[model samples]
Target: MLHATISGNVVTQSTTATNHSILAFLTSTIGQISPARIRVDNNTVINNSTSGSTRGILVDTPDTSTSPSFDATVTNNSVAIGDSINGVSGLVAQARKASETCTSLSGNTVTFPNGTPSGIQGLRARQADTAVYDLQTSVSCTGTAATVLSCLNPSATTEVLGTINTVSPGTCLLPVTP
Candidate 1:
């Protein structure tokens, strides 16, 4: 899709399935070019599964080429993750190609249950290519149940830039407070 706007929606999953509840992406086949501009705002995502890895919201461009560009804005979204064995992230924005990818995340909230196991990320921004990828964030939280830093993905290629309230510990630039 070239352009899309998704707002004010509620997505809930209460099963053991492992998948992304809300996903917006742009993919290309071979030499095809698929540039996308997407806006996701004011959405509520709740995951009540007790097993497997899952994502509440995912926005990504998986095509690894310079011909495809991606721009996304995710704001004012509420995400909740339940018990899981593997990595379960509340919100994720990724650019997996050597393209111009820009993602902005602001005013989002994520909640994890108490005693949440390891590999649970409240918010994550990743850039897996050597392109012009910029990820910005502001005012995001993981409630009072989990540590904000521990709930973030620490990758060498990933950088979370912007204003965020710190709550707990691990290794992150901006930590979110409840």
Candidate 2:
């Protein structure tokens, strides 16, 4: 759904999405205009087996001269993805500009039963990624395959401030407490 001029919307208690081909469970790709608060909680996103990139939640603002600040809260959600999927990220917040703030993902469970070498980023933030960001119970490699179950995917960006939980099983979560 598009958030052109909408703000302060809360999406909660929703079921899993059958549309797995899209970018994420909740995504906002507003351009220069920054939408208001969007809180997503207590939702379940399961069986997302898209052949392409399938992420859990995404708050994406296109790169501009200045960072478009966004306010989002995602919590208490359960997400599961199928194996053999590529470009799969659990939680992603992309602010390619500067000075963007107030985006948080906490208490969310994400699991990848099937693994892929394409890499699974549990929680990632782009330009605004700083030490202040980290995955809480996010980032778990399931199904026990050495080649696929490697949650040690490193950050390509230099501004990652939080620790990605490169651990295993039953501990997949993310958080950005601002």
Root-mean-square deviation of Cα positions for candidate 2 versus the true structure, in angstroms: 10.5
Q: Which residue window of length 10 is worst by lDDT in model 2?
A: 149-158
True lDDT of residue 37, candidate 1: 74
Q: Give the TM-score of candidate 2.
A: 0.50
User: Candidate 1's error at 56, in angstroms?
Assistant: 0.2
Model 1 pairs whose backbones collide: none
**What's each prediction's TM-score?**
0.69, 0.50
Off by over 4 Å in 2: 1-35, 63-67, 85-87, 116-118, 128-178
Instruction: Give candidate 1 misplaced runs (Cα > 4 Å).
Output: 63-67, 84-87, 136-178
lDDT string for model 1 (1-178, tens) is 4667788999888777677888976677666666777788899988876665678888867655545666677777888777645546678777666555665566677777544557555777665655455544224535321233333322211224233233222211221222
Residues 1-178, model 2: lDDT tens digits: 1222222233321224433322322223433444344556666555454544555556564444443444555555555555454546665655444434354445556656575335555555544433122222233423322221223222221123233222233222223324
